[model samples]
Target: MASICLGRQPILDRNHNLVAFELLFRQEETEETAHVTSDLSASANVIVNAYGKFGIHNVLGHQRGFINADPDLILSDIISLLPSKHIVLEVKESASITLEFLQRCKELKQKGYQFALDNIVAINSQVELLLPLVSVVKIDVLALTRNQLTQLVNQLNHWPVLLLALKVENQEQEAHCRQLGFQMFQGYYFAKPEVMSIKRADPGKIPLLKLLALVMQDNDQNSDIDEIEKEFKHQPGLSYNLLRMVNSGSDGLPLKINSIKQAVQLMGRKQLQKWIQLLLYTSSQSADSLSDEITQTAVTRGKLMELIARAERPHDKNHHERAYMVGILSLLDQLLGIEMQQIVNKLGISDDMNQALLNRQGRLGQALKLIEAKEKGETASIPSLLSELDFLSLNELSDIETQVRGWTDHTDATVN
Candidate 1:
């Protein structure tokens, strides 16, 4: 199955506790357009993949799922498939709130479904019709001025619906919304992206590179446990993070792993490789150059490309792993502030991955293109880009995103 990238933006209640997650699906392509041929399919794909591949709890944890629904998706039996108690069906602003559509919503409401109005900009007749049916109204806090925000809140006061502020960018905006009596908030304000400068790789990175090389070695016969231990000893910080992660109860080890040797033996080469790769991505210490956001993007790209490679060539484990390497290393130039060729030469990665990183020529390179497109929110261009590879679909791509997000979150929790 092709792995898709699923992103969840947290929605918080008045007390700042996570109450729900808006399920977002991103497909990678090279184009920069937002026009998709089928909003219904996109919506349905998100619901299907969120419920099917990743499972609701994996994506949303214990919080409710806020899914956007088009008019067609609203009418379909797919809405009935979702657990009513765990989801709040969001009415898309573009959805024509005709009498028939409202009737269907009412039917679902009678069946114990909840609704939210997305992108509320005005108090129009259609919005007025949906106001009573929806339990929450999501207003774009960034798009509206203070006066407009106040006017919208004042207009909605007649209804018992809760106000949910979207696109809140900072504490100031969040506080402003709270002052305006908005009961819920959503945005990237909490963990803002850090600006990383172009600097030479740190001295500590040398040991990490050595450990990475040892772990990524193709041979199984050579017992390099002692050498690996030496590398960890050389870098105490990496060792500490490694031990902290192993003992964090995230690995589910029967006994506490106190030493690097114990970890290496128990984790094996493949698992160890994965763990080290994750560590390289998440390390925020002075030695690690990449910011959390950049690392997250790289990790997500690696996972999505790996899933795509798996779908294309199911029997080729090497290709799958290499595809993942391509994804993670695709952004190495930006992360390390080094030339792509120089970076690849230092890492000793495969020619295919090297070519993909530098020129985007091979299959892995094409996969990277899609990942870039998804990162750029170019969903409409993905289909055309992948026209040669018919096995991949937009929904499947989206599903992979969800899976990766869960994996990233789980890894972060474990490492932290």
Candidate 2:
């Protein structure tokens, strides 16, 4: 099998909720051109890799996935391999839209497949023809003027197809699209932090941070456990969640834990620390209500970094934990709506871990850079980063990513 690199970009609804992700992939050798000898073969490989190798639920969770489809792939039987109800077949505007193509798309639609017209610049004959067939029409807002966009949206109003603003880069674009009645949006806008007058951590999260500090203390004395249990006593919600999580058997605890003290003893400080870190994300909000994509992104990064550290160091457990911590903490600034230095100062992490989170300067930092690059679809930078690691190969890294996806998916389910 060819070494294929996979990437996903989130698509948000009008309310800025994560609704789906646009799944992207390219063969290792064809990174630049993204040219495949056979479109059908490449598409088949993507489906097999995403559904078979990566697992659809792992990659998509409960959300749908937008997959690009050329006419050949759209018309072929291979497309049926995907869960039709959970995938949106994104047909590019460049496809040869003939009567046969229309018929094939209609046939698929009848079978529960959804379609989105990709990179639509103007409402021409092709756009007009496909409007009724596709559930969505992705407008290339970057390519059009404000007047052109308004005109296009007006023309598109004839059909009930959802208007999706593509390549929206900032809040300005998102706001404009929402004002223009675009129902869905795809871009980096959500990842960008909103400007706020005061940047402070949420009050509810403060106790979780304190508990994390107590759990992560380096002292081996019994008093460390006492301090942790004391903190948990003050926060009944946190204690209940801890016991509930352990009882859920997601932590692989041999027996049920009834109290915070028992949890600390059986799970150990390291595992306890891990649970606190994750709990920080879900403590105040219900699992289902924690809809921010950044939380899932943080968890995925942490697990990937942890797995990579395990692969490299093998027996160095501390290094693995630090890697996971750094990966997750790297995004705390955006998550908490505060500065990275502020969060670091509150946690009082080691200098090395601090550097990894703030500056991306250490071994953990390098791992984070690789993960970020993969997330942003910067496939070109992957080779150099892999070379810098020196202990991992592209195939190995891909496998690690596959593992992380599945692990994070399971973690999300357990938390939910």
Candidate 3:
């Protein structure tokens, strides 16, 4: 019953936001035969060669995706799997971008495919030669020195290639890279994906459970709106959580609800009860007794972030799931005060999401790290994270931050 999750990745729009997203995805490939440690790769050739629609519809369609492949894999399957007009093909650094590969890439470009050079650098002669063919260039910033970096920055400014500063270790590096003009970034400084364990009675779920209990204890299928408000007010955070959830969506409600009573009226009692119970069981809070505020905060953050991710990536991709996973994971310790891996074990999250959560060695992990950094008020690292997610406009980024903060404030006030 493993479920694919967003992990701790940051979900960005054309602007970067602390969005809720399905940053990671997976198949129940645990045949015990599907090695737990296989070298991951992109199979673009499967797309081109395949007659029908690319299978990327369900698999590898997470908010942030990573695929690694050697020359042979790309030369053979990658060309086919590449949907050209959509999706990205990241050529592994292990491959030599010989003229032949470049020629093939050129042909693909003519057909509308986009390409990225993974872990690129100065000595990566093949990438340098094919710079014109690439849409994005990811550099392992950890390995580059100030001087080497200077050369790349100076040389790339004139190119159309988007520079991704990968493995940016800290806020200082993020700042320096922004000053040097890198487009996106990745690193450990962003929130590290953590695996936590939680129990049903854990304090994390107290608020949610309390709300649930109160609602259930007064089992009137049609409780008065004021009574419902009283229930939420009894707990410190419930009203705010409702406001945050409603406001998070694209069809922003016309009137802002400042209290739980209004929210109860807005959503009939039946709907409110169902959602509250659902929120209680969601990954946001442990399956324990709940507080009004913590429970509502988890729900508010998860729903709000998900709305942001879904809006930015309107396609059928699982961006919402990614966004929610990160939002919940970010607040897990605060709500539960438990170790992370334990949480993963208790939940039904799939292996790939676990990789992003536990290892932070992949693409989704990097994105999550970025979101964590921004949320912590580290503005300098914003650029690098955006680069990792892709090119982002400052205005969109601002909107996202504003939305999250607004939701946070709204949720707090309503709940308090």
Candidate 4:
């Protein structure tokens, strides 16, 4: 149940009211620059994860969703899975503008599914063929020069399609698009992605490494407390943060927590382990990347996998814990810039954990893969993956993802 990192950009009307969100998508093996894929299944997966997995309302709230739809999806019955009332099917520019495509749009239009032309830069015969069928034309404002923008606007003036200016990065662009009669606006001009560079893992992680080892080796003995307390004493910063977080409004303790020992006693082994796993991400030096976003992703992934395991093995609490470990640890290589085996050995985790992390073997490993596939939008493997896990369906996966995301958001809000 690693959380699918669903990206969304708001689409605003001329009056700057939020009308809808364009759900950004990426699949496994795709380029970083590619937001939405041309693959029909990729689009379907996005829909499934968004409306199905993440809960359409959780991601979209009261507004609508504008999703990318390639030619195949536009013509196929799969697009029907998305309720027409909540989504505007955006046709990718590469889709051949043909009589059949138009016919399909026309048919869907009859059924109340709206359509838009995505990332249009110019007007031509093909564009003309589609202009009547689509309700909106998304123009990349950054892609068009001043003269071209004016010309394109004038060319489309008589057409019925509403113009949406995309990639609006400043007030000037916003004003220009407005003056040019663009009916909608989108881009970083509204909100920017907080940029962060991956830094080398902090040396501080060594203490966490010790704590992880101690927690992993717990034999339900009093000795576990001494070993863990010793590790905490060595890392004053970690102890302070842990105590502060546990007492802070986020943990919502009925009694104020004042000591590491108290926090450990109250949090217990399982809760404390998850807390430490989260600490591994924050222990990094970077203020933004590892501290906030990366840690959130790992936490979400871990929780999702844990939920999936619980669904599959209701009584096996140990399996659920292991699944969470596999998820958060899966990102160890990227976080630590070290080999998975090296990190696994250093942490003294079980062989099963090692196999799941390094080789993607066993039930926990499969759970990890299922989460990864969801994140990557690899729909092809989703059915087979679900079948192996007691026939969990796409809708079930969506619920799991949505629940984990909500939990992660709540935890992050508490910690922050």
Candidate 5:
């Protein structure tokens, strides 16, 4: 099957709750923004991969998904295939506001499908006509100044449609949008850390860090397992969760594990290491917390990095393991609210992994850079990064991404 690369960005409500995701069609392998020659074909691919290959529940869970819709898609029968209740079709701003376009939107609205006017910079006759039909209006916040944004918000206040601030890049922008009465927001602001020098890693997480370091160490003596088991004993909750995860394995364990040692033995060091990394996200907080999205993002990154490494090295298990570690650890600073350098220092990871995590250097570092670029929608830089890793083509990266997304979605569902 041809690989599909889909990029997703979280959309938060006024309360900063993850209420939806803006699913973007990415064409990282090609020179054009979309591999398909036409926008209709591009939209078709996104809908198929999201709702078919990945499944809606895996992609959006219980939250709604905001998908881009050009005029062609908006007026087509294919749009009806999307579940009306779970989807919010975003009408592209560049779409011509003809009478037929407006009529089609009204038809979709009557069928229980919601529409959002995408990247609205100013209120005009076209926007006014569609306001009543759309349930949401996504304003291009980055395109306007503070005064312009406030003025636009006030103008939009005349309508019943909810205002969504698009391209929000920082907390300050989000606050401004909230003050301006934007009900929904889409951006990378949530993932970016507000670093504080005084912030330290949670004391409870220190042991998990040590356990991670020990597992990644070169020493394979039985003493290593004893030390790991000892650490888990010190944290009974971690031990119990480990056992639970093993028992609940999709491929059922051949033997029941009665002790931490047994669980460790059954899972082996590699799998145990991954579980401990995952526990770093779940053990400290509820699954419904705001950090849930961040945890999911980290897991996705880790899996993508691992797949890329597998494709590149093919035979180097250690390199693949480190790639996964780099991807997961890349976001630790955001999760822990501490400087990444400090976390790396504490983990005592190898120098290559350290460079990858802290500076985005080395082979693994370039892979991390590619993932970051993909997340930020910097598709222009992707081709060059792919060039650096000549062994793996863009099609391979797309395939790897599709596989990683599926794995991460499954892992998130299982972990929760």
Candidate 6:
């Protein structure tokens, strides 16, 4: 998944716990514009312009969105183009702290638009001029240690400007930042970031991929099962796994599955491929011979949320697919040594699915993160997050383990 300007961890008090995150959003691609004007005046398009639609839409309903802008945009009439009060105008680091930029910032602040100074460091820079003008001063965490951060916090401690620590990477860093009195946190340490190179292959996949390639061929919209498996006469192991999955009681098949034909006839295309993928994980690579239970946790969570959406709202969605994708991909960064998008494209996922995983752009991404937080047992913040999602509690979400446990069990059982 590509990192769209997705969501971020909220700025925390020195406690290293979440207070509320800086929510990132994707600019919806709509041809016709409403709140923003056709004329691009001051801000030369150095940064990708997010359509103020997310802000406007939030405005109509009273929500908040943060939009980053340059000094040029501040000087132009563009600040007026913002939809409503629910926006935080982030003054980019590249922008000058000129009298004009400061004056416009003061004007926006007067109009209820919060200003954030991006990548601020060393209170002495032009930041000294703009500090009194902005509400939040965001510092990149990578550049500071506990000592330097402590010094900065002590210095900025008296100022009303909030100290936001952005891009925190691990528990130690998080804890250190908390000790240093940072008010916000953001980074990739929460979910496993996908790695580009997993040194070993799933030993089970070599054989399994070959079999799956067989099954995938029949999936051609035109071909029948018998016609597809017609050429493979010597595949016994493939014959057995399909039979086990078909007879695995979950399918409720009337008779036992002995051949690929029986599996094709009874289980159908969709279910069979799922079993094959799960079984393949039985090999040593990702599963580490562990059960699919770990991955299933994510899948079940995704599916349950999807079900909640469907019953509550009524929509035809690949909620289950999205769920499985999240569960499996949570470990992707480990296997691939890269970001989620690198592997997400290898799978069949929808735009919303991609949005949630890579960019944290959709409803599902919010749901997934909520589940993750709950699982970690961050007692106080989860409910507040739930409040944002407009959901009651973990009562419904608690059912996720039931959905995903079996997959984990399959791989675990094999290892044992």
At residue 225, candidate 4 shows an lDDT of 80
Output candidate 1 Cα RMSD.
Answer: 14.5
Q: Which stretches of candidate 3 lie over 4 Å from their true place?
A: 1-15, 18-66, 93-96, 191-416
Off by over 4 Å in 2: 1-4, 28-38, 191-416
The order by descending lDDT is 5, 2, 4, 1, 6, 3
Candidate 6 TM-score to native: 0.37
Candidate 1 lDDT (Cα, 0 to 1):
0.67
Q: On residues 89-129, what C-alpha lDDT tens digit does candidate 1 reach at each position?
A: 88855434456577889999998899999988888777877
Better of 1 and 2 by TM-score: 1
TM-scores for all candidates: the values are 0.45, 0.44, 0.36, 0.45, 0.45, 0.37
The candidate, 2 or 5, that scores higher on lDDT is 5
87-109: candidate 4 lDDT, tens digit per residue: 89887554244466678789999
Q: Write the per-residue lDDT of candidate 5 for residues 108-157, one digit (tens) a residue.
A: 88988998888889988767777888889999998999999999988988
RMSD of each: 14.5, 17.9, 22.5, 14.7, 17.7, 24.0
Global lDDT of model 4: 0.68
**lDDT digits (tens) for residues 236-291 of candidate 6:** 54454344434432312224446667666666665555555544433322234233
| Model 1 TM | 0.45
Clashing pairs in 2: none
The segments of candidate 6 whose C-alpha lies over 4 angstroms from its true place after superposition are: 1-63, 92-95, 190-416
Q: How many pairs of residues collide in each model?
A: 13, 0, 57, 4, 0, 22
What are the per-residue Cα lDDT tens digits for candidate 2 across 1-416?
12324566788888788899877655443242355443433455456445433446656677888888876566443454455766899886542566767787899999889999899988777777788889999999999889999998998898878999998988888888999999989876665211112121232577877777777768765898888889889876556545543443232232455667887676567556655654456432322233346665676787788989999999999998888878778877776666888788778788889888888777888888899999888999999998988899999999887655422323233311
- lDDT-wise, the better of 5 and 6 is 5
lDDT of model 4 at residue 336? 62
Stretch of 10 with least lDDT, candidate 1? 192-201
Give the alpha-carbon lDDT of every model. 0.67, 0.70, 0.49, 0.68, 0.71, 0.50
Residue 111 of model 3, lDDT score: 78
Query: Residue 387 error for model 2, in Å?
Result: 60
